[model samples]
Target: MTATASSPAIIRGATLQPRPWANGLGISHNIAQHGDGACGFGWMIATAELSGDAAFSHYPGIDRVFTIIEGQGATLTLEGSGPLRCRPFVPAGFPGDQATHCTMDGIPGRAFNLMLDRAGWRGSVTAQSLAAGHRMSLRATAIHCLAGQLAIGEDVLEAGDTMLPADNVTVAAQGAAAMALVVEVAARVG
Candidate 1:
């Protein structure tokens, strides 16, 4: 009954509507909203048509980290850190309300998002491309395939395969065009 890295987590179809943002800042959120702040432990999602030009903003209740899923180039100017050039597959963490902006050098695509509630849980995320039989060195509490195709053991995850960790064991992907999203969550009780 346990979910594994080789299986599809939750396959979410593309949405028809858009989320709120400044003009020309259209985006779509594929988030699981069941736990805290529209998420189990937190919110996990992907965003489309994000501002590629240092389009920084703030969320009132969620601390967020973003991964540049696809695009030519982009940069993030944080409130208390150095400028982050949005590189594909690179995960960057920031304060929920920290002021920021982004600029890109190419077209925009789906950018993955992982948000944690400021008052409760803690989490981190990353996106990596794995060739058939290739593996990742990072270990965490959970991981999911957000895009592309993937296979772990006997299961095949096409786009949304989610898996729970096994004693912090390392999970790997074994197929072309294999990309996975890793998240580690621990509840923070106040």
Candidate 2:
């Protein structure tokens, strides 16, 4: 679907299909992607559910951002780097080609994942909270609601729903408060 400045595209989390991880250790629900299938995507977004200790899939020439959304979180051990503590609402960035391992905190956890092709794209994720009636302008590529509800134009977004804006937009908190993850994607400059 084509999203215009006046109308953004919404992806409902419940409608996403689950796909097995490349390493076959976990499952992920693909949210959105861009680029040609023949050469692979320039960027992709998804939510992953990890149940136990496991190694991450390697994606050469790509960068990744993983944010814990539910549960107690996990520890990520990336090759050539110190162990990363992944807690709820915190996003961690790393090279997708790096050998990485994840150790969960006993129970299963869910995370939002972003992958970008290093040669052409760069991206970042930021968590934000908006008070009731508060509005925030978005220059972001996408925004995922983590809690509460948000109103963007005539559309209302609930937790787990994601919106891709074609241009800068503003979102307002619907109730008491709302939490979201704003994602920004841009072409890599040489």
Candidate 3:
């Protein structure tokens, strides 16, 4: 099933289906189904305890960006590089195909993850908020707000709101108290 939307053009929202991998290290699924204009991108919200002992190999075709949402604290090591301590709300990424490990001292937290094939697509997730009446006119990719309230168009979207932003994607916020995220998905051009 797909839900379609328009800000001028038609957009759609597909349900995030469940896909279990890594022997249940975690669970994930595509929020969007098959192509209906919006394609070549992957989004997964992760809810799991951090572990380095799991021993993860490189993801051959996927490029991933991870943003911590809730947790104590964790460290991510990229092969030769030393561990980078990660806190809640911070986002980071590297070649998914590279040897990577995540370790936590005590408990695990939640994180948002977006993974796309390095060749056909690319994407990013941020923990910042948008101000009311403030329009970001960046022309690179599509925009979607997964959390927070956005004074978009004329409505205040409270989490799980979205938009496909290219050039000319403009909106006037209703109030200054509004805040949200602008996730851009862009096509990789050779």
- In TM-score terms, which candidate is top? 2
> Per-residue alpha-carbon lDDT of model 2 for 1-190, expressed as tens digits?
3478666899997898999998888899999988632228888999998878899998888889999999898999999999999999999998889999999987988999989998899899999999999999989888999999999988899999999989888899997799999999887788
Report the lDDT tens digits of candidate 3 across residue range 83-183. Answer: 76777666777766667777764665555566666667677766555565566544423344544445545544444444544244554444564443445
Enumerate clash totals for all models, in the order shown: 20, 0, 1
lDDT of 3: 0.52
TM-score of each: 0.69, 0.94, 0.64
Best by lDDT: 2
Q: Ten consecutive residues with minimal summed lDDT in candidate 3?
A: 32-41
- Model 1 poorest ten-residue lDDT run: 7-16
Q: What TM-score does candidate 3 reach? A: 0.64
Ranking by lDDT: 2, 1, 3
Candidate 1 lDDT at 103 equals: 68
TM-score of 1: 0.69
TM-score of 2: 0.94
For residues 46-93, what per-residue lDDT tens digits would candidate 1 score against the true structure? Answer: 455665454654665677877776676577787788887767777877
**Residue 138 displacement in candidate 1 (angstroms):** 9.0
| Predictions in order: lDDT | 0.61, 0.89, 0.52
Q: How accurate is candidate 1 locally (lDDT)?
A: 0.61
